[model samples]
Target: MYDIQTIFQTANPILNQMPYPMMILNPEGIVLAWNRQAEKTFGYCAEDVLGKFIPFIEEERTYFYKDLWQKIIHSADPLHLESITISTKKGEIVNTPITLKAFTIDNDRYIFCQFNLGSEEQQDLLSFNEFTSIRDGLESSFMMLSIDQEGLISYANNLFLKYSKWTPKRIIGKTFWQMFPQTPESSVVADAIWKSLQNGRQWKGEAEKITKDGQSYWVDLTAIPIFTSAKKPSNFILLENDITDKKRLQNRLEKIAYIDQETGLMNRYRLEQIVNTMISENHHFTFVYFSIDKFYSLKELYDDQAEQVLIQEFTQRMKMYFQDSSMARVSIDEFVVLTPLGEWFIQGFLTYLEQHPIYINNSTLPLSISGGITKYPDDQISFTHLMKASYAAIQKVQSEGGGSISSLTKADHKALHKKSVIEKRLLVALDKKDLKVLYQPQLDLITGKITTVEALVRWEDEEIGTVSPEVLIPIAEETGLINDIGSFMLEQACLQAAAWHRKGIDLKVSINSSVREFRDKNMVKQVRRILEDTDCPAELIQIEITEKFALEAEAETSIIQQMKQLQNEGIVFALDDFGTGYASFRYMQLLPLSQIKIDQTFISTIQYQPKSQMLIQGMIQFGKSINMSVLAEGVETQEQQDILTEFGCDAIQGYHISRPIEAKEVEKLL
Candidate 1:
């Protein structure tokens, strides 16, 4: 056998000369020997480290090596190879696998170890390669930086150098604060990184960055802190991703969602959101709801293609007039503009729209709009209330005739309140049976005998005196109470007319039906049921509808056909408010009728305006030629009465004959 002393000495030299790290400890866990590889791996030579506690390698190693020594001492077993991380003198971390063996020499216990340093460098090289591959593969502009605890940038990638307008030589030693000094105080990136380093955590978020060229960009950043062998932070690794294009794309999508596709203006959905937001914020603003006049007719004349061109041209003209106003397309033919402007500006804009004509595809389309304006915190506070007021104003202008714009005034509010009151009372009145029908007799002009009775609706409230048909009728229509009220009126009228027939008075009873009631698909069925229940002849019930009903093509066709069907069953149809609408002559030719009731307007102005008299005469002649009877309404004077008789009017009705009377008074009148 070789000499033990020589073998030990020769093996010790080879171990000390090895390029890897190695250490030897006694059974009591004291550092007995260390090799040159250990010195290079740990930045400590054998002289300084020998005889020191092996746990002194790191704070974590204190418990780790202590347990290893205790296990070896108690069981006399060697520990298999294991991986561990330790700190070097320069504060660099080295991960290595180590093996320990228990040996004895001269009756003393010792633990020998072999450490591998190349394993850690191989891992670090693989990680570096992965980082470079990831950085190069990204399509978006990006940056990577490694920062030390003292805030000095130790490394920067190629992309970072390009974006910072600096080379790696200049940026490697510079701090972030030095690179971008004008960064806003609100920036939390540096603070977040510092917090992560102190707490050994990770952080990520989007941050605003200002470049060397003073241009601003958005970046998404992720950062991780590197730790030492003692589990204390040493440095930070940061990855930055440019997200400016993503932000731009998100903003563009949001804009597309809220804007109208054709006009590129705010859509109704956006308008509603704005109105609700304003109400929630209690901001004062004004809104104008406007509908283009003759828009439907124009749409019918020119198809959707031409209509789109007209709308674009109209929006351009409106923008020129309103300037900075926020406009939106609220409906197919309606545009709403919300503005902080006063009445003068709104009025001027309306006037400008009224005067201009949209030139669309070689056609000069007349651009006229009827608008209703309501102000916030002044007209109403609730969004729904404001919208109602605005729409009410629009309806007012539409009813009075188009091509006009009106603002909600004190009188308008008072009128709305009155209507509201009437609507409430009308509901109660229906339940309490407070609604009644009054009769105005229509007399044969030649024989001076009552030929028919006109049924007029009347309501008496306990709080307010009497509500006129003009006021209560519209309220009922808007509130959808017309169906109930009309049913009551029809039942009452039929019952009273049946009572007259019981008295052997075979006269037709005429009852006015609103356009809303007349257009109902169930009106004919309901009327037939009423006649059957009251035991009255169908011929005794004459239903009157206004001229405005004929203007709506689809609704009018349905109503007229239903009426003709009922008339063929012996009921009669009469056109009320004659010569008041655009298509009266066409309606006369198309509808089945028994009489034409001249509108009160022409009758009221006949004595003053010759044009009114001539129009009435022409209408009376047209009625006679069609073999239809003509009745002049609003015949309150003998002069008016005589003129109607001279013009060959068949019947007349107004205050002159008899004001509307209740069912009891109708018996005396007959």
Candidate 2:
């Protein structure tokens, strides 16, 4: 420690004698000091650089240098490290890693610095190699071309030169229209590209291009806009690929799938797809399915070639009427059309087709077609239902005698009357339990003592009190409410029969079954549940089915067989409304019928109508021959009962003794 100032002054020379470039700049950006390493690295002598302003690198490649300086100077605590590029004399570029430190000596600012060039040169060299390798190895027939905002080419690549058949020097700065003067300016593909560029959107399409030799070919081109940092498009990039053969194969496949080979119209598969799409999109469209009237007979009358010619001529005439429609050949003699029209337009079009006869192969074929028409978003919610409604309507027309167009109206009056009366009351009845079971005591005619009772359903409406079962029962059957009503009646009757069993009466009761209820797949299950719930002997519960309901038991053969099996367990079935329909005698052998109830129509007329008496007598004799019990219904007069008793009827149930009584009232009778 001999003379500290002298020792510090001696250490300064060694600090500045390092092998790397080093310089210190003041806060005012003036170069205050430099070393011999700085002089050699930057190609400036220390005497020439010490008092000069530091060179501001203005090259676009080194623009970030200004930003780096501002960041360090304005920061409250200046940073000590940064890497930057600087331009040298002789147009050479070098990168340097620098370390800086700020120190204040005399209330003014100062900075100390260090510099190194150890690893930066290697990084620059590696970056340059990667860029060149990628630029040379791309093989997608890519071209780097720049286009001005005014649609003029400013640059072109080598690949573009060979494809355009023009030298790069000549075509680099030409506008597209000027280079290909004969190209169609108003073509759809060209207009799309121009529109995209004007709107600053990317455009892609197949376009026709002409070479310098005037040879034309198809090319798929994609044009993308190059955006600046401000997000405004500065130029465009156009990439093209040859696609002629690909397009030809696509067109051939489409023809095979959609075009009808015989009629040259759209095939059924295409028509179905179009209809499905239209329905999915909720489009307002009208569909019409039609078939040639008597076409099968016409084919028999004429030869195959003649029929073909007739069909073609018929289709042509149909096309004339539905010019703006989608026409398809759905079958040999059936055609369908999808149009955007109202009912009036469709009716008028069909009328025109019906009135015009076609001339085919030097003969008048006099063809006519029957069609069904329906509108979209009105009649159905899907294509399947639309086709179903149309076909059902078309079948209705053809079955009544073809040769006219038909449209679906609301359900017919009979069906509506049935549905309205039944569905409205059945819903309310189920909630209110408005349905009551009326028991008509079935007597042994010989002893005149009640042994069994028939359970008849009587509807007591709150507003319209006590509706006759005849009117409401048919209504219920047609609306599919009969199954519910029948089950309710069965449950009530079983409970009453069980109560009668407890009272030592042991009287069996029967309930009527409708066509719908008898054919219901769940009929046996419902019956089993009620019997099990009530704990009634199965023999004490009989199901009374009408002769008309028995014929509809085809699909329910297994159910009918189940009923017979249950009959073996002591349940029974009576064929009610006997002699009311045809083939009553035939069904007796087919059905396991325990009893036959003669309808009231013949019973009330036995006094005046001799034919009624004879029919009743014949039914009784028929029942006797079959060894089946015959019960007479609607006996309103004692003379009628005496007549039934005289005829040796098994049971009598009518107003002559007592109308159907409720369970509570029948309990008193018991």
Candidate 3:
């Protein structure tokens, strides 16, 4: 057992040096030691907390201490918890972050909890009194409100009243979530807020809300729960920051990336993206590559300006006919259309084109339109090959005397039927339990040990051998089968991690989720159910979500709430494939992420490219600034690992560590 006198003599210097409060508690939850900072923070001297069970362990919340202690004692790992409740000597409630590490000295159990609450000076710097200063204060646009335990708004800041268009009379009694009309529809968001607040945890996320004018807008919201001295819920402080302008800018960028300025049609790049999506989803559509017949001669007949006008007229005509199709200009006279049309429709389009003529300046221009048509899933299924096949048919039409539509021949149908059958079977593969979950070790750069491994899914058909994830993952996303696959992976990963934990390994397993899973309304409940079914500790599971997951506005609230709930249960998130998409800092500010995995594209060239190294530096710095772990993906060489470590990457995963291995095979490495 630890001798109190000896412990003080040995730890006095270290205890006083800590800037934040540091308290030592025994296994029974009795505080044994308190530093100067602790006194300053809780308004309690060392004598006040020492020999006392942590001041306000509410009877209902007592399990929180038990669970936390059990996790640390069994896992032998230091656990950091945020938004813990505490009561000061003055009988005031405070929500502060605490990190607890279990230790044994001479067979005695103790937990050292470091309270990372900032100094009193810092608190004063942001106190409510100063915030009351209108003109120079946090004046601004952010709405702030305080909600009492009864769910009534007890206080509203100036900005909150201004935005609600209410004089204190109308706003005072309204609940925080009911401030606007849209709040009632977001039940998932409201439940999370109420649960987290009553439990002494903070809830934050971006959700659309209705203003007094009945206009909808997005805001970054945060609500911190405050408790009374008796450990009963008192109220919550909520802050809302308007992010409409940021989203508008992102929407503007989305347009610039996909639309063609000249023709008001989807650009070539966007057209390719659409084609790829269609192929992945196994959607059948007709692809037509056509050009005006003898366009050079036709353009020479008119001046340059007149030629431009004629081209615009032809596009207008095509637009009139292809209402539901995606069309784009490939060249001066070449245009392509991807339509969900059949042969009958194509023939009708051809006939319609023959009956009409391009009229400019009240003069008829006799121009023949020829098209080559190929069907997805029936002809060449690969997007690029489909495009080539359509062009070939177009050439065939021009050779056969123009002014016609030509269909894809045997050249485009090579093995098409077999591939379609295979795609159909692959959808049911997960249900049959034919897919495999493999693990690839990730090394902690600081510790130089394997701490986490990503769970990757693999599939092999009885008739067709191994299927590449690259091929099937996209198909799964498009066909809405990813949710099934994701759930399976999560269950398997948890089961495997649980097995490792049985061996006292404390391994963390990473699972990837598609945007579709986030879109599912029951995602949060689903995740909790899987954890219970597998008996997997939430702390050992990490979910990886990508930036593409943020494209849809409606799904944002669900995703953010689910992530927050799971994270509060001790699950961590990774911004997978970072730097590949929009890479918005908004996600970093709002999402409850633990790490940022630098995309391989940036790390692969870091050894030789100065720009790549600079980008890596910026990412690492950004992660540090936001208190997130920096991990590098696809590190294949010692030199690359060294460079990443030199720049402060916390962990790394790639072939350099080891390719994904089967669960049984992982034992040898362990």
Candidate 4:
């Protein structure tokens, strides 16, 4: 089955240059190839040995040579005979040492023999039979393959065929690289092996290989380059042990410990490991964090099975696009990727999404993703700090309404660090009841007396000093701490109003509320419980809401119902910053609003800007026509206050009257 002529012809030049005799023979002792050196050593020409049995071994030693031939065939490793008696054409007998190895090509087996022609004084005799016995007893337990200097498979043992599922005809004569699947990693291994063998060095490692049917298996391989007397490599011998089972078990354990089962990507722990490794090596790379926008909202629409399918497809696309990067799934909707610095493909991915939208059940879901980038060894020195910095960048995008990408800046880092500290301390402050309330009074234009006071929550931390509501409120809401702060505001405002009523000082205390507060179904009950606990008259308490809350109330009927229930209990609702937001008459009609507060933005410059005066006047007239009172804010000067008074503004609250004060100061004012 083997192309014996081709193998001999390929090795013809190298064989002729050998310093010692070399011969190729079949299992039955017939000569196949007789090199020039073999002819000189045995006194036989190519014509005499061609297709013929050996005529060099003595008749008395013929039985011993036959026994040695059988040993070589059964042994996977090369065998050597210490001495053999040979008779040349001149009838002169000589003792020679030789080595022999049995090799298979296709279904045919051949023997390669090399003879040492020098005398005992010139060459030291080795225990060839003993060495062969030891090798046959131990090394034959593993599979073997022979590769020529050109790296083609000259021969492979039955063991290789057994484990590789490859027949002799399918494997023989092929280059070593052909046995492996075509991939970057496999190519790298093949190149390394070739280089090492060419340099006359032994190569040893564990390699994963593919079988005939595409199943993967692992092998512990040792390749030794076989050299000629010229100190140049002629062929390589490979000894391999199948390690598939052990590698598979190791892979399973690694999968459980380092893989995200949902998407088959690296998990958070694995990402941390890789990042730490990179940091130790001082390898500069960018860490990019990705978050799917409104992921939970989309997830709620699908069942668990469909969600998993969607997630798999999403990650598959990522793998294809970012083929060179390392990626990990850090959370349910968050993923991270590590790439060379300045080589991020996120912008390209965003563009790709525009052309290809992910669909489910024939419907295009509103899918958008955001990314944040941080450089390694540039932004942070450690993996934990790097991840935190990247997350801060992501938070910036999320806070700005998401669906975009951003990189961490020095300024952003400082601001985000401050925000984190504030958030943590704010929790402690709430627990300690360190937050206090101040009241800003509203003066009735006709009565010339304060009629209502707006309760504003203020926080002063021992570590962070005073944190403005503008900075702290958004953090509280984002962190879900606004519910606690809102509840505190309602309780304190009700208690203060009750105290003032008991003192014969009639004042309606208004407390601002966020739309998020009403997300809790127990908000109405909580307010009622607070009023009852304080024994405050419902008429003396007012809940001021912004136009944003009013806009949401339009769609969320439950919030509007809650407002009406509170209003029915004799509590009042005023739409604050009326002219500053959407200012939709629809929400104004949907909600049971007692009054509309003209935003300070319009009243602040009403005295100079006639357009402001016109808008203010129109707001007041509209409020009165709708049977709702009008109040103007930020009346900082008498001219501004008098202008509002002239415009028929029912009430005004600002510094022009008096700045916000504590409950004691309000008592004195009353």
Error of 3 at 22 (Å): 68
Flag regions of model 3 displaced more than 4 Å.
1-354, 357-412, 415-419, 553-555
TM-score of each: 0.47, 0.49, 0.45, 0.53
Give lDDT: candidate 1, residue 25: 69
Tell me, by TM-score, which candidate is best.
4
Looking at model 4, residue 54 earns an lDDT score of 79
| Candidate no. 4 TM-score | 0.53
* Candidate 2 deviant stretches above 4 angstroms: 1-320, 323-345, 348-400, 406-436, 441-443, 458-484, 514-526, 552-560
Worst ten-residue run, lDDT, model 4? 118-127
Clashing pairs in 1: none
Assess candidate 3 and give its TM-score to the true structure. Answer: 0.45
The lowest-lDDT stretch of 10 consecutive residues in candidate 2 is 118-127
Can you write out model 3's per-residue Cα lDDT over 1-670, one digit (the tens) per residue?
1245445433544566555687777777777777888888889887666788776545577778877766766556556576888777787788988767666654666776777662121121233333446524444555878898878898887876665567788778887667644544576777777888888777777667667777776666777666546576566777787665444433433343354444667766577888899888888888888788998888888766667777777888788888878898766588888888777876787676657777766788877878888877766767766776777778878898898888766744554444455567776687687789999989998877888999999888888778788877876776677888998899899999999988888989999988788778798888889888888899999999887775442247777887788899999989888999874577666778888899999989999999999999999999899899989999899999999988988999899988999877776766
Task: Write one digit per residue (lDDT tens) for candidate 1, span 1-670.
Answer: 1232333332444455444576666666777556777776688876676667864357856877788786765554445455677777787776777656565544555566667441121122123335547655542345887898888889887776676677777677887555443555534666665676668777776666666676766666767666555577667777787665544433433343355556778876578788899888887888888888888788887765777787888889878877788889876688888889887778786667657766666877766778898988777665566677888898889888877778778888777666666777888999988987888989898888987898888887888888887778778888888888878888887898888889898878888777677678788898889889999888788888777765553345787788778888898878888888666366666777788899888999878889988999999999889999899998899899988888888999999988998767766876
lDDT of 4 at 33: 75
lDDT of 1: 0.74
RMSDs, each prediction? 30.8, 31.9, 28.3, 28.3
User: By the TM-score metric, which is better: model 3 or model 4?
Assistant: 4
- In model 4, state the lDDT of residue 344: 40
Alpha carbon lDDT of residue 565, candidate 1? 83
Expressed as tens digits, the lDDT of each residue in 464-518 for candidate 4 is 9999999989999889999999999999998999998898988999998999988
Q: Which has the higher TM-score value, candidate number 1 or candidate number 2?
A: 2
Q: Give the candidates in order of TM-score, highest first.
A: 4, 2, 1, 3
